[model samples]
Target: MSTRLPALITHLAHRHVSVPGLLHSGFGGTEIDQAHRDVLDHLAHAVTAERHRVDEAAQTVMRGATTVIQALSHQMRSKIDEMQHRYDDPGLAQHLLGLDHLNEQNLRHIQGTGVLCGAWPGLTHADSHLGDIVAGAQSRIRGYHRVQVTSQMEAPVAVVARAVEPIAITVAELLANALHHTHGTLAIDVSLHQAESGACVVIDDAGVGMHSDETEFASRLLSGQRTILLTELGDPPRTGFAKISRLMRQYGFSVSIDKSSPYGGVRAVVFIPGNLLTLLDEHTHPMSAMAPLPRPTSPTRTGTLPTGDAGGTGGTGEGLPRRRRRDAQPAGHLPAARPDQAPTPEETQATWSAFQAGTASGRAASRTDHLEGNH
Candidate 1:
């Protein structure tokens, strides 16, 4: 029996372990305790072995991800170099203009598919197109205009694409505004830094800066103000500022406009949340094997149809009562709105209609146009 017990333990240890089954045998007090101890030791060793295996697998996965990203970056850099060298070619400008169309197609695809993994390729392609455009534009607009750029933290291709697209758009708008509104030498200084909260990208322009009050108003509008103030200067036109504001809001980032700048121009500070940077970082360390958090569900909308009448109950037909009867309700319970501020049926209908009209108009005009040809 003694000899058989060792053999049994050895066999069970090599095979699948069942601690309870191992302890269940004809044995005395000491033997029973020893068997229990052996079972526990086997389990601990198995757990350690499994954990080591998992760690090695994770490391391998991470190495693979790093390799893929490095290769993608190398290819992009090589292509950009080739394009830079071809800049002087007589037909280079025309070819880049053609690539601009391809850039638009890639952007549209990214929007439709929501495939962020393809972001670098799409962005690098678009960057090449823009680089050509910038070169062409510079030849004509090159006077005393100043441009400075600084960046920190290795930017992943995907991050570069997502970050640069909106920035370029905003900068283009600013440049156009400066060219038309301001005179004399214009300069732009851009800096990117990593903060404890997140990454911050600042752009400063030495053009005719906005007035103090106007800058404050613009700052407020950028910080989640849906309705912009139309100043006594008359309608400011929604061509540039309004569009920039809308895009910034959609991206869940904060944009601030300040009257102060070293160059005596308007300063724009864009705070990029670390989440996007983290996504790029994860791509660098994909072997973690930990699943990312699910995206939060967007808020549900009350799709109430527009209807007339001040306080009639049947408007929109979903049985949402227009009035809250205090007597019919439980004591101390309150409705979401105060009795005075509660929107009247007419007001609600008018507001909803306006919103719907604006939404339709925005969608129709949102198709991005990359203006070609030098000014």
Candidate 2:
């Protein structure tokens, strides 16, 4: 036994480390503990590093996807417009007009998509009026005619160059929600108020007011206190509020749903601090003059459908209940957006419906990939 013990010790100490190295060697108990800790530290750092890489890759993919969608959306819109103008058939032209509206709605969705991914490649520095921004938002929403934008800005108030599109997108989300919830033709009022602290975009709707949990959710989003995840947005994902929340966080803004409108509906207030504003330069033409907003030729109907409402009666122009609920948005995570050019009329008349429906599979298939985690 004695001989065996010496032999065992000799074998164990065959590669014995020097005294200084023993403190870090794998053989010593303390050294073994330290080695384990070192390995853990390395693993932690590797995980952190990998997470950053994944995040960066995701952003890149999102940015690219937004760019492509904007392009397709713009092209289709232009085709619809040109077909409307050149063709003499009023009936066919009307159909084209409908397609054009869908294109605009899709554009709005894409813009929101861009907002989520932090990719706004559009006009960044514009000397834009508060009304111009409101108009832009109104133009993007489905029921633009139903939204009345009133500005009490005494001076020629401008959204600073960096803030123009982000402000527009934020306003669009607020306006879109307001329009979505109300009776098909029920009017929404968006009033703009500017003060020293910041600018305010107040949206009042006549739809059913929000529940407490919904209100809390909206508040969290608008304040950017919560981070958005794809899983949280519900299946088929209503990305509108989530999109605006990201922009609000990035752009140094705040939105709240704490107030009730005079019409017994939801009142959403978007607070844009003074840093986002600039006095309109005399040389600037704020309005882009793309096209006039369309009036609602059809009567305002009840049962208005939301964009992604697949349940109940399917998300159509009509089917949503009049008392549709409103959601909230938060913090300023705004990305500057530059949308692609819009459609020509021919594309709207003949080809748009098919393209819109997913007949064009190549690009459409990738849409999910780009927006997978974006919601």
**Candidate number with greatest TM-score:** 2
| Position 253, candidate 1: lDDT | 56
RMSD of each: 27.8, 17.5
What value does the lDDT take at residue 27 in candidate 1?
59
All candidates' lDDT scores? 0.39, 0.58
Candidate 1 stretches greater than 4 Å from native = 1-146, 152-164, 175-184, 228-238, 279-375
Tens digit per residue, CA lDDT, model 1, 185-243:
43455444445545555655666788776675566556655432222113443334554
lDDT at position 197, candidate 1: 49
Whole-model lDDT, model 2: 0.58
lDDT of 2 by residue, 189-238 (tens): 77766565666888888778778877766766666775565445666777
Give the per-residue Cα lDDT of candidate 2 at 25: 48
lDDT of 2 at 15: 25
